[model samples]
Target: MDNAPNRTLLDLQALEDILQQGAVRTLFQPIYDISKQSILGFEALSRGISGTSLEFPERLFCIASEQGKLSELELLCREKAIARFVEQDLPGKLFINVSPNTLLDPSHPKGETLHLVEKYGLSANRVVIEVTEQDKVDDGFLLLKTIEHYRQLGFSIAIDDLGAGYSGLKQWSELRPDFVKVDRYFIDYCDQSIVKKEFLKSIIELAKVTKTSVIAEGIERLEELTLLEKLGIVHAQGFLLAKPARQPPRALEASQVTQLNLRSQSNHNEMSMSVGCLAQIEDAIGQSTRCKDAHKRFEQNKSLMSLAVINAKQQPVGLLHRDQLTEVFAAPYGHALYAKKSVVELMDKQPLVVDENAKLDVVSQQITEQEFDIRRHIIVTRDLKYLGLAPLRDILKHITEEKIRHAQHANPLTMLPGNVAINEAIEQRLRRQNTFSLAYVDLNHFKQFNDLYGYASGDSVIKLLADVTVQVCDQSSCFVGHIGGDDFMVVFDGDDAERLCHQIINQFELQSKAFFTSEHVEAGGYWATNREGQKQFVPLLTLSIGLVRPDLESCNNSHQVAALATDAKKEAKRYRNSYLFVCNRRKPAAPIVRIKTTVHECSV
Candidate 1:
């Protein structure tokens, strides 16, 4: 007889025992942002009968599902979660996970779910139904209608695991969910991937379009949080902000709220919106006087797999969560059947929806903060009918890209235009076909110096170089840009190019002393071994000015001239001292030196 103090993984039998014994529990995990180092929200997780938390939420539920106790376990978890929240009487909405198949069960309505909420003294507004996009629904319309009925009673819905399943743009456009929770996988590395950032940005954009708010989950790092906030994401829920506790957060008093080192209102305001805004969007959606946007409509739904939805006036709404339709739709193109299918047959029974006249800010907050079941798309309409669909991923992408653009244009270290923008600026100069010289400013031995000192010292070197470039360019006819790392580019013409380069070297040579050790500086910048293993002394921070004068002789295209300037800079470096090189590429071996510096003429 194994009378062991049971220490097994939360299996179905154990979960069943826990559920039957009412020993199952709910624990909250804190979500944090890596960038701002702030607390966003807590994710509610299910615990097993063993009186300990499960290793993973998905695994815990998956095992229960395998045992055929999924429905029972979900219901029990809901009840337990509600009771706990009710006991704590927390202010924020309580997120509850529900299976679409189970929630849509006709018998589901008659079940103890609603009774449990009511019994626990919880408001439907305080409860958000979580719907997964990982699975397909048998009856799309029935699913929608069921959730809609609940919405009317004040409970909200949220689309969950957006990037995990077939839940992206299509479901977003059709469901019009009040809230869109970006999948954790999307949020995990968002601080790194631009494509992911673009995808998430699109989700935010769709949210704005469909009158929904976005909640980014799985934020564990501050940089990621900072990026999300900058992208205008309304709410964040992850581990870094705060670890989940048995008790939910209590509403702070005005003073306490102000005093707390939580997310700034301006930051949150940047992310969220007001109900008034949502209400006004009604006119924007219906009055889309651009009624002939059929082409655009088709383009948006080109990816639909099932029945497509349109507005009340019979225009295509978007596609429903195309689980079955994507699988069973009768079509030659597979998704083409949706384009041909009757809106009524393929449409969700009750599409996720929101009124445009609602408070935009409140709605947005509700969206990012609330939990929802089957959070698909958010319908934007004045009178409860949808005007258009909002794809969650697109919305997130737009906002995030906007942030990325801002960050790229504005430097992170010295806060300057990066290489991309520098290239653009050069293109703009070329577009105007201006006679400008491109100056190449580089630190000679930055790596060797920084390696000997520290990264902070390296950063100091960059700042010193940046300051020198700024001072020289701003005071003259040139524009300067950091080409990245130790390289900087300046565009100018005539004697100004050589003049600016000299000014930079003169100034940087002075500033370089502070970051160096007395001995290294006293050696008068002698060559030390680098990874290249050559005697390369910290080349006195200098600029090799490349001047390209365009008259028709050299070439008409500034692109050609810019390339010539690059070659000229290479030539100038051969002199070993700060020098300027002018490219009269049309003339072979043109002027090599002037009093200021040596010039090496290169060809087109």
Candidate 2:
């Protein structure tokens, strides 16, 4: 017992040594609620300060508990944690790590812990004690009693890292904790790994049934964060939210919240077919015919009153304002002469024009960085083909709305832009006829595999597919989108088409091996399978792609090019088992693509 450094001093001596000499100090790591996209809390991690570097408090706590000094160690960590959380004025929850053995002690010093909470002006409610799922914890009766005791005292309880190697599914049955934290190992590659995503997603479903709050830890990228949000995760603590510091973080800003809203609202509105190019955005601006409403809108807003007028063709031709019109009337150049002169003489043809397809952030950055003319409203277009004017105030308001909605409404898997983004992308591609590739990807026998392993495992598989697709395509030239579930589409060009598809599938299979049972991985490192009784080897995950490039010789307009690409993509789907090519060239319609052998013979 005396051999454990933590228990060497015994009782009062150990407590005094920990406080006066400061044997333990707590460092915080930010934990985010994946659904909310806001910093929900910080996980208080304990570290033993040696002469120089800090030691893992887990080792220290484990050794102490083994030596019968868990009570002493837990008390020391709790005291310091409360002091720091209070001093920092952290607005969100303070999550402190606890050894399960410590909490299982019926005679643990709850009285001292209560006194410390009162001393620091913190409610027992705001603190969540996180016990690691990495350890073997089977003390059901004691855990229950301890939880009941904490519940009465207003303290929340959480089971940390519940889907990792040493997970305890039985804790949910026994302890009924208020929160369940999905571990980082499950979340780290969630954006791309279907197996890991399903695994974590099942945990989320379980949390929902238990009515427990779920938070995903270790989010580092926008795609990973988006996937978690879509999977219905609510509380996240991660580096993207902010690194833990000595002070509390400011709540997510209004602008941030607005961005979230715009994304969410867009998703729901985007799925149905849009009438024409930029029709949705045009509807969003609430303008029917251009000039009728402009007269009324200009009258209502007196400050910076001006309107740009154009014919039905949207050719910029006139500028009008109450002030400008009044000046023209009073001038020696009478109303007849002023009105007779073309309005184009006054209107700035060189007006600052913004591409309508750009994100809100891009527009905001442009406004901030560029020198401006007197116009407060900037003309925007889809790919610089004029759509409408974005008033400065409207842009600010829209940005603010975007943050609020996007923070709470992001998707958790297949972070390739969601349904709303899918619509915008398709519209853009169809309008431009830029000869990009639209390759639809779906997993083979994924559902059966998921059913066999359970939903958590299924989600992991889905996330893996998304990750592979994103990695395989070039972010600069290719546009990848998730049309919900495991179905995904990648837009690319002719140059590296087949090679890129094969590369993505190959990488996905390689990454997915670890998640599969050894029996699933056949000899020669091949993860072979039976697809409808056929001996199919997904050693390089089987991906079906349809490629369409503009047939410059056959098509006169961009619309025909888009239709050709669409038709080619459909043909590609018919021969969907492997890497296949379908080009929209000028040749007479040939025999349809069938097996990989037939398609390969023609394309090669």
Task: Evaluate residue 387 in candidate 1 and report its C-alpha lDDT on the 0 to 100 scale.
Answer: 52
TM-score of 1: 0.42
Error of 1 at 328 (Å): 42
* Top candidate (TM-score): 1
Error of 1 at 139 (Å): 2.3
Tens digits of per-residue lDDT for model 1 on 1-604? 6633353443545665676787766886543332333333345677765534443566677766666666777777788888876676454457777888777655444537656865655544456777888877878887777777666555668888887886467776767787778888888878799988999888888777787767888777767876887788857776655456676444323342223323322211122222223221212212121212322343466654223244334322333454434444444664443444443333343433444454343344344543433335455554333355554343334445645674757567877666666666556655666556666666655667677677997887898888877765654445566667877777663355666577777887787777766766677664667676776556544555665554434454445555666677678777766666766663223445766877999999
TM-score per candidate, chains pooled: 0.42, 0.41
Write one digit per residue (lDDT tens) for candidate 2, span 9-38: 453354445545768877777665433334
Which runs in model 1 stand beyond 4 Å of their true positions? 1-12, 30-42, 51-56, 106-111, 248-263, 266-604
